[model samples]
Target chain A: MTDMSTRWKRTLCVALTGISIVTVAAASASAGEISVWVWDKAFNGDTMREAGEIYTKAHPETTFNVDDTASQDDIRAKLQTQLLAGSTEGLPDIVLIQDDIAQKYLQSFPGAFEPLSDSIDMSVFAPYKVAAATLDGKSYSVPFDSGVTGLFYRSDYLEEAGFTAADLENITWDRLVEIGQAVKEKTGKQLLDLDMNDTGVIRMMMQSAGEWYFNEDGSLHITDNAALKKALETYAKFYQADLVKPVSGWAEYTGAFTNGEVAVVPVGVWITATIKANADQSGKWAVAPIPRLDMEGSVNASNQGGSSWFLLSSSDNKEEAIDFFKTVWAGDQDFYQDILIKRGAVGSLLSAREGEAYKASDEFFGGAPVWQNFSTWLGQIPSVDYGTFTAEVDAAVAAQLPTIIQGGDIDAALQAINDQAQQQMQ
Target chain B: MNPALLRRGLVYALLSLAAFISVFPFYWMIIGATNASADIIRGKTTPGGALFANAATFFATVDAPRIFMNSAIIAVVGTALTLVVSSLAGYGFEMFRSRIREKLFALLLLLLSIPFAAMMVPLFVMFSQAKLVNTFVAAILPTVASIFIIFYFRQATKAFPSELRDAAKIDGLNEWQIFLYVYMPVMRSTYAAATIIVFMANWNNYLWPLIVLQTADNKTITLILSALTSAYTPDYGMLLFGTVLATLPTLVIFFLLQRRFVEGMLGAVK
Candidate 1:
């Protein structure tokens, strides 16, 4: 009985070993499919699938496996965990990463991603978008949508306050605060909705002046960053003037503007889709250039949120993935026009801005050439490095926003932000 | 009115209010599913005529059958293995009464305090080395001997009478037969309650499954609904519809096993 039991155990161990080998062998290779991980199925996922369809028509042997099963947070965690573990066996060929957080991943896990500029032309895309993901003199991303900032306002409310769309054009943050106070008094409505937790507006203001949380050498640029201090003071003036509506989260933030509780939404061009989703407010809305900071180097244009496509260095189908990206994302202008009209995505391909879809006037924005104006502003956006610690610093800034808005000293708040962010970065 | 009657009335009113507060979100979700995405975003309370449209869109977008099958297989298999292994270990620790085993059990409870996020990298490395990434087996294996479930069963086993095991032993029953014929039949309510809890947990499991299961076709209902909600302009109607469907299995499991759940609680208390 003992001899039989020993023999059984040995056979079972051998069988388990054989099974593990087969599973490992099966996992290592996917014959021809180039897998891409994207977050939004409606926007990036379906768009990439369409791009894949376009590619497959030319080369039948190659196929695309576009997986949008994970959230952006999930993708970040998965990528960070897998890359940190030094395991590339299950990593996808391509993944879509947001523009602001791209530097964090690139710097943290160096050589984990394939630098695309070696194969694709970096200059064909918007300069600001390209500059976002470029690291150590090498560009690494295929720029997707442009989050070019725009001042989307209700025309009826502005007119009720005796102001025209021209009054909103190329205004400064201080001037906008004045306009907001006046509009609130005249129309009895809030001028803008602000989420205290979100530091997008502050970042936009800082970027307009070509400043970031980090200096050129990636040191902490807080406490003495003139542009950021000015931006915070400008942000405080909104609350001091009593012209902003305090809201929380994406749903409430967008709801405040869409339901007409607020007059203006100075946000990314991607909000065009959300704004346009309310078809009843179509002709009532119009777009203008986002306000700049009252600083020496500030411009009227700044960016909010955008993302880029990255190829993994560990990808087995690296060559095909790059070719697929070049053919559809980088090379195709008509593809940009299609996605723009269909999904309201503003692509960053500079040449695509001259496409007919961009030039066509929209009746929604009161028949204004909104796309044309957005493209023009896209070029004027100052390039900032968006260093690795933007997320950490943004949290620090968010922590101090409530204090600053309540008439606190900007210098004291800046010191608090610097201390907290410095601790977090460690 | 009598003061006793007044107190009873107040208690009833408070209970009703508490119940309403608990159930309002579920009601709102149903109403939102029947409304357009815009109306839902506008915070409309009234139901509209979009249920069929939302259902159609959800079905078209998600492969409901395959995804449901994947969820069912993982949840069912995971719950079964968890109940068996955890119950055996719980029984062994309680019945055997050794210092070393007790210390090992204490060590496991201590290990449970470490967050899953901190252990995810090492766990992934283990799975990747074994080439179990992107498989249901990988998702289920690590979860089969859940420390939380084992702790639960260990506590519950204290209430289990040891007299039955001795009674079965004098009747010429071996340890395995005693466990099968004596303890198993007596612990029906406990097992029923555990089945519901474990099944619900496995059904709603998200993070580890997400990290392990990579393919779209291999996704669960939770992951699918999460992806839908994160869209730039999320279709609220379809998202709520998917949520309603996703919530039904757990609701049904709870509904069926609630009687046994109460009984199991009563047994544990005794």
Candidate 2:
């Protein structure tokens, strides 16, 4: 009995081992496809798949597997884990990382992304977009979307409140606050919906003047930075004067104005598709230049959120990935035109603005040249060095937001932010 | 006697209330699936006209059957293998309590406390070396030797009747025979509980599968739901619908196992 039982155990162990070897062999025979990782199936993933189709039509041998199955947060966690593990085996050939987290990866892992400046003409892309990806002057990333802010308002609502679109064009934050209050009183609709947790609006206001949470020397630039102070003070003014309808998240923020509870959505020009989604509100909508800060150097145009594509240095197929991006993303102007019409994506390729799509006017905006205006504003968005610690600093600022709204001392809050952000950055 | 009855009543009440509290999030999730994105965000409690609309959008956009198949294969294969391996180790640790193996088990317990983030990279590097990356086998292998399950089996095996094993040994039955026949049949409840726990964990597993599973055709439902939420302007109605579907497997397993697990746990305690 003992001898038979021992033989049975040995056979069971050997069988399991044999099965594993068989599974591994099956997985290795199929390996021609290049995998891609990116967030946003509707936005970036669909865009990449379209670009991939363009590539495969010419080169039938090449194929792409774009994994739009992970969220932005999930991709970050997964990518960071695999890369830190020094395991490039399962990593995607090309991954879409947000511009803010680009430096974090580049600096942490020195050999993670290939310098695409060698393969593609980095100059054809926006300078600020290039700046986000450049470390020690070797640029990475084929720049994707631009988050050029615009003041999209209901023209009908503004007219009812006895104001004009021209009144919003090139106005300062202080003047807009007064206008917002007056418009609210007249129209019984808030001027804008403000998400309590987000600091995007304030960051946009600060960056319009070409300042961030850091100095030109890359030191903390809060506390006494005039632009920062003005941005916060102006932000408080929106809430205190009841010029804003309070919101909690993206759904609520988009809901307020889309449902006509508010008059304006001063967000990135990327939101145009969403605004125009209500075809019933088409001619009623018009965009003004984004409001400027009440301080010097603040422009009517500032960026909010944007992302760029980076090629992995560890990829076996680097040349193909770079060539793929350059062909469709960097070179194809018609492709840009199509994406703009289809997805409301504004490409960072400066030459793309000169495409036929840019010249077209929409009946949706009452025959206004909305795309032309966006292209003009895209040029004026003040360039800022979104430093490596933007994520850490942003989290710190978000933590103190309730205090900032309650008229807390800007200096004290800045000091608190600097302390917490410094701790987190380390 | 009256005071004792009151204490027992209080205990049952408290346990029932705890179960209710644990279950409310799932109820809220179900309710959210029935409402529009607008109403869901407003914290609406009631169902709305949008369940069919939300469901239709989900079925249209997602390859649900393929995703479900991927999830099912991983969970079932993973749980079966985990049970076989972990139960052996558990039985081995209890029946053969020697100094060297006990010390090794202690070390494994310490290893369990180390966060997954720290070990993830090293494991990935090993998998990459073997060229096992992006395979379901890669996803299933590392978790099969779960220390938590090993610990669980060892504890439960303490209650295992040694007298039965002694009687079998006297009847000339070997260790392997005793384990397969006597131990396996006796520990049916333990196997059932472990199967549910391990199956649920593998089904809801996100980060590892997200990293290792490279292709959309190879993706699981959790990954799909997560991706749906990350869009520039995600359709929340569709996203919620996906989450409700993603959360169902774990909920189903929990409900099915709860009655038996409760009875089994009570019997073991008594």
Candidate 3:
């Protein structure tokens, strides 16, 4: 009995000592060091690193540590877990979150993120981008990229189908369906690739008409949303016309388009880099304004997946991190031009569109001023309040996609989406 | 041809087809590493002449040596510690039976049903309170007491003969000495099998380590590879090259331990 008691005491002492050692190590973190967490090393990560260099050039004592070791999903999980646990020891000074899901993070974990409008000028960014991270009249994000929608189609394939670039400009979804059917018949290829699990096209179509899954008061807007019903009807038309080649996940989705199995890819401007990487098809592709839904208020422009930089309130170097974002991200037009040319990252700064890089014509798209066109459309995209339940509603839409594609009733599908989203929101 | 020969040929053909299907993705990965990113995206199955370029790009972009070192240290240290602690506990539970200990062991099996995601928040809080966040100790500590490994060792320990313990006792060997010199030598095969399973688990561990390891310099290859794959314009050639390099350690470990690993499984069954 005495031996067991002594062993237990020794174990307790050792455990306490071990914890103290870890505490001492953690306490030795250096001052003036701001760490930023980003997911894509090629795009945002390297951009942030260059921004850090620019900042450090001016303030020699301050430094930046940018870690891009986690994927976006992984970073989201880590951040959500740490924030929910209320332990901020391992959180980075800054993180990049997608604009669509920003509301979820902002509303669920209030006061966890620092509102950047407190320090930076929010008016300098595109209004739609700023509106995404704004809540209760306080904006929390430094706007980064603009995922302005574009209808990237193969000029060669469209030409084979006897259509001009003018035919694609400012078109509606019904006109796009006719064009897609013509292209498929003439070229013996599918017009586009659609993933059943992705509701990106539907969301883009709805947002083009200034509608979302929720109304201004954050209530479900599914049953009577005319824009949504038209979008779903358009989505079903592609499958009925046999113009869409079904694919799964990012690789297969991109592969279908890249391998020339499909012609058109209606995606964000961010995919320009991916489309341009196949240099053999340099002049084969052209970008047009995205097709709007056939609705009362639909427009030619829309937005898709974009992201913004957020500062964590728990940051030890909060002031330095804010200054770094201000100096490099907001004020530097030349830096935006560099990332635009190098990484194809289109920044949301309205002034950046005036830079020489954004105005220049590209031989890749047969000398079309694609960047200039993208900048113009970026302005006209209608703003909508993407409520905290975009992901839940997106999943609900995806669940009904298979049934909808099989010629199921559009009203029934919307009802099903409403039911699923209602259950998930709870 | 004889009917038996025809049946044998059919069976062989089916086995070959199954093997090819099983190994195609690995073959595709190798071919992908040898091709340009554009070619891979185009779904080209044939090998191309871009292997050296892909390797150069991967090495240029990734801090390969540092990331591999971090993975090695965590997996090696975590595996060794887990083996010693879990094996000891397993042996104790099987040999020195008690009602409370048995109940505790049963409760542990039930605990295994709870997913890691459910307990991640509480575990993070505990490590944060200890101020061990971002340390290798934090990544290694929570995994060292893995209940699945404990259950594995416990079941294997049942196959350990009681006569060996009795004979060691008659030879005046203490419990600790018997555990070390007698039981350990006899259970070498069991240790070999557990080493592979535990090492693989530690090497591929993603979630907890991603949450714990904060700095880029401290990240493992798994996390780095995942980040690479999620790039807006992912370079498949460079990404697959990193995967081939990352897979080598596990392949080498399995190759070295396969003979004893097989015997260990047979012993457990017996």
Candidate 4:
């Protein structure tokens, strides 16, 4: 028994040492590889890979290594921890950041990201896209997808309610409520699905009027903002009229619309892929300009969610990375058309709108030039300064959504939001 | 019905409900792997015929062999190192006489109250200074000296017989020989229980490996599966298939040591 136990210990030690040596050997990254970190495998990952392949075709020495093995939340946590530690060893060459939270990182870790406007032409992309990443005089990111808002509705349901595509164009939120009632009365489908935890619809309404949760100097603007008040009132009207199918999470939210339990989905262009995934619903769907707030300055166009790529200052292959960005991301119009057709990615490049793919009609959306319409709204989206505290203010807003939808006073809720946001911002 | 019989039936019904609640997710996951993504989202509970198609998509998308190898290496090595170091500390604390023994052990337990989130940045800095970032060494090192595992072993060590140590000493065996030959064989059940616990924790570790491992090829199956679920249009069938594959190693480990695990949990010397 004693000899057997001693031999077992010896085997364990040998196995451990052998395994460690093999793993360490397998981990050595090659030189000239521009490693990128992205979240989505099908959307941003494949897009970046295709761009890298194009760049590598022209320049043989440089290659790309894109890792899409972390979720967006996981990537943020990893990036934030590494940056906080001031450790540049494991940091990627480039990372994808959402437009709303770009300012948070830029302010917290100055000089951590390379300012790209100095090298890449900022004028070539949409103004709002460039403006989101610009601080002081330099823009820090090359914009990828546009989250320009659209009113994706079931055409069969709307037609059954005696409505047309022209009826949805250039309407306000109140008019939408009326149209929703008619549709629900005739077709028996709910107007839309609303998740109380998400402040997306409210924010989209505010953005259409060129207002946000913050002032120009990054002060709380929740109270005394007419756009916000109107947006809240309109939000309450949906629940008051029983026109909403209450959902909770991302899966339920998307599932409600995809399963045809809801008639309309007011969201960003990024949802095009999710909607198009239900291929059997082709020609049953149609896209229109998202409805605006019934305020003086509001327009039919707004944005909900979008993300961009930021090059890190710790990159060893800076020249190769910038050139790759310029050649594929900024200058390749045909590349934009390819991503648009294949992945339903609506690129922020203004010139890409003139591509053949943008001109071609999609049969999935009733043969309406959906891509062209999205690009038009993409250019018209009013740019807002998403301050470093947008996430905090967003939480404050989400907290009051339940009350706001329950016929609570809009002004009282605004005051509550302002107080909560003011406390958090400090 | 008689009151005693009714009470027994009520207890069995409650146990059945608890069992169903615990077992339903695994059932749903298995059934989900056999259905299409759309059908899964539509809440289809019954099994379908999409298992082969889902497996094909999963295989095509993920480099399963490479990632599973990465996960296996980290989990196996980390578990071994933890058991060796922690069990030795457990034995020494219980066996040897020292002035600061209990004091030092208490201080180590106190460190457990400090959450991993608070120490993560500093830990990352230390690993980066050692130039081990992005390597499996960085992923496995911080987890090896788990304080909770040490505490567990010390409790289990309380049941170890002191007579064996005295007998080995009279026979002229050294301390190392006693620990290896007598103590180890007697405490085999304790080690089995620790193996299952440490293996599961290391296998499911996410945030640390996510922060340390940079490249795609160096990532683990847990990280890869998480990324797959966050896609705009996640294919539930393929994802469930990947999860079933990811869950197999842990299930196998538990089954192999199951009887010993139950005994070890009751008491090491029993």
Best by DockQ: 3
Candidate 3 regions with alpha-carbon error over 4 angstroms: A1-29, B1-14, B268-270
Write out the backbone clash pairs for model 4: none
lDDT of 1 by residue, A1-426 (tens): 969756764665565565555432333348689888998887888888888999999999899888887888889888888898888877888899999999988999999999988889989899999999999888889999889999999999889889998899889989898888888989999989999999999999999999999988888999999999999999999899998899988777888888899988889998988898888887999999999888789999999999999999998888898898888899898999999998888889888888999999999999999999999999899999998899999999999999999999999999999999999988
- RMSD per candidate (Å) reads 4.1, 5.9, 3.9, 6.0
Candidate 4, residues A1-426, lDDT tens digits: the string is 969756764665565655545555433336788888888989999999999999999998889888888899988999899899887776778899999999999989999999999899989998988988999989999999989999999999999999999999999999999999999999899999999989999999999999988888888888988998999899999999999999988878999999999999999999999998889999999999999988798999999889999999988888888998898999999999999998989999999999999999989999999999999998899988888998898899899999888889999999999999999877
Among all windows of 10 consecutive residues in model 1 chain B, the one with the lowest summed lDDT is: B261-270
Which stretch of 10 consecutive residues in model 3 chain A shows the poorest summed lDDT?
A20-29
Ranking by DockQ: 3, 1, 4, 2
Per-residue CA lDDT of model 1 for B40-141, tens digit only, reads: 877899989999999999999899999998999999999999999988877777888776987899899999999988888888877766667877877898
Candidates in descending lDDT order: 4, 3, 1, 2
Cα deviation of B232, candidate 3, in Å: 0.6
DockQ, candidate 3, vs. native dimer: 0.51
Clashing pairs in 3: none
